[model samples]
Target chain A: MPRASLSPGAVVGLALRIVDEEGPDALTLSAVAGRAGVATPSLYKHVRGLAELRGLVSGRVLAELTEIAAEAVLGRSGDDALRALMDGWRSYAARHPHRYSVLVQAPLPETAEAGDRLVGVMLAALRAYGLEGSAAIHAVRCLRAVTHGFAVLEAEGAFRLAEDLDESYALLAHMVVSGLRTAREMSAADSTPGR
Target chain B: MPRASLSPGAVVGLALRIVDEEGPDALTLSAVAGRAGVATPSLYKHVRGLAELRGLVSGRVLAELTEIAAEAVLGRSGDDALRALMDGWRSYAARHPHRYSVLVQAPLPETAEAGDRLVGVMLAALRAYGLEGSAAIHAVRCLRAVTHGFAVLEAEGAFRLAEDLDESYALLAHMVVSGLRTAREMSAADSTPGR
Candidate 1:
């Protein structure tokens, strides 16, 4: 809150707080500067600009998610690892809905490494399926789609039925694991001669 | 574009055009009013406000998509129907990236019936899968997640690999259909006598 104490990290932290609490529309340079007890132009001394500040927020969110995912999938493999990863992410999204949306805009050019780290954990969970090359990439895409899409839809109140959302999510994870196993089988079948 | 010619439909059409061309940020009552050759205050007679205008856009988008999906899956069943539905949506999202996002915010309160019509087409596509009740709901959710997630991520430039995105989408469709069949088999197994 003091002038001398407002560093770049402090400015980003405040900006993130604003987005997390008041929503993204409130995340302007002026608001961040005001919250930091500095004039609007003075923010130039802290963050490079509003764009960079937003990127920093995305990077931080990605880094945090990567950490959570890495921990959740550690020492696990196959379906066990995949389910853990999805559950862990579902929890993160539920706890910080706004920040979770920020994370979705992740892997910004500046935060590419953080994005890859998160993606790596997901890819690792699929390693046991033994898909390689293009199949491997598509598997990752499929995993992300199921998890992220479900989260976004749920957040948008799209699952209006009284049926337990947890149940639906659990079933979703089950179906995806089944699908991956089937893909592995299909790939194997394709490579086999005279099946 | 004259004031006498401008109606609620005209305002929403202009608003959707703005979102489709210039992105969501450019969509405002003033922008729509200007495009309609009417003052911003005149929008009150055509639509309740910005929110209602936006909701109309979503409704129109949903109606359009529902028609496409209905046509794609007609006379098809099982995996064929599912793939048709997804491919139809992918084509829509590809052609109207911005309006596609608007469709995602859809099924807004004012657009509930339109949303249900769109959803019904999808549910009908899944009819051959034979899942009912909660499983039915979850199946729809899964289908939606895979399709919507894949679209959103692709649009966001998240799938940066050199691999063919179309192929990946095809594989995704295959995987989801396989997953649904598995769910059906599992449910059947549960209902049957001791194995």
Candidate 2:
């Protein structure tokens, strides 16, 4: 209980392991304290409370995802860039199902920067489609939903059939890209001077 | 303690209420027992245990979803049928956010009939696209992921932007249908007698 060197980073690292292994519900001050070899109250000096811990964890999770997206899309453009970013996203989700599972929840205030950066990467790749305003945003949501939805379903064993998931994922990327490819024309068509 | 007439149906009804009002995690035997005005042990006489209760709940959820999809797609075909089914899915998820949250998990054996019917409805809608075998299965997964992903994200407040979600959903349907309309060609292309 006397480990004075336990910084917030150390606390977050332990908490991440807890989240990665047992899921978000298992995270608690007592749980982290037990892992950190300290009393639950003693840990308050390092982090504010459970919410703060979760925020820190969220920040880390989003930041990591942003990095993966950036790396995957680097030197790529158009469908290739978008596909790479999505592939990185699903791979991250698959590797860390527990962490990936929490992503559906809105990021906390502390994690907004990381969250925005992640969105920025997605937007950068989506730039290839020339969609603007609402169309671009909708495309973002569609891509996110596809990857997030597919990854979560696969992790939960929802796809019970014997079909190859990898193949399905590739097909999804193709479909979404096709959808993105049309957003511009759809927008332009909507903007035309017609009744 | 002499309520020997309490049927399994009664227990499931109570469990469904708990899940609807609370969530999947809140469906413990003790909680259901509290709602049923009986001891946890007495409730066990009707339902086997927590797992069985979950299975029963899953069956109810899937059955209800199957019914919605069937009604939505009735007398419709191709994109209309597909849109109705997807709209039905997202609306059902929005209405029963708590119950919908658990659909990602594998359906317990008891829920297989309901689950299969749900898949059947989806397949029926997709029949107009003329996709079969792996291509058909992949298309199904794509649709499932879009609705599931969008619903879950929306429920969790993940879509923080100011864009209209309804419009985004419509766009998603359009994009996915466009992708599906080509699945037949994509499949045929794969089977062509070329190296």
Instruction: List TM-score (chain A only) for every prediction.
Output: 0.88, 0.88
- Of the candidates shown, which would achieve the greatest TM-score relative to the real structure? 1
> Candidate 1: which docking quality band?
medium
Q: Which ten residues in a row have the lowest lDDT in candidate 2 chain A?
A: A100-109
Which residue runs does candidate 2 get wrong by more than 4 Å?
Answer: A21-31, A48-52, A104-114, A184-195, B3-5, B22-30, B104-113, B184-195
Sliding window of 10 residues with minimal summed lDDT for model 2 chain B: B101-110
TM-scores, one per candidate: 0.88, 0.85
True contacts kept of each: 0.54, 0.71
iRMSD, per candidate, in listed order: 1.9, 1.9
What tens-digit string does per-residue lDDT give for candidate 2 at B117-187?
Answer: 88888888889888878778888888888888998877656778999988788778877887776655655
Query: Docking quality tier of candidate 2?
Result: medium
- Can you write out model 1's per-residue Cα lDDT over A1-195, one digit (the tens) per residue? 453588888888998899889866578999997887778999898778878888888888778878888899999998889989999888877777777666555434877777777778888888988988888888888888888888877766676778888877876787778877777666575579995
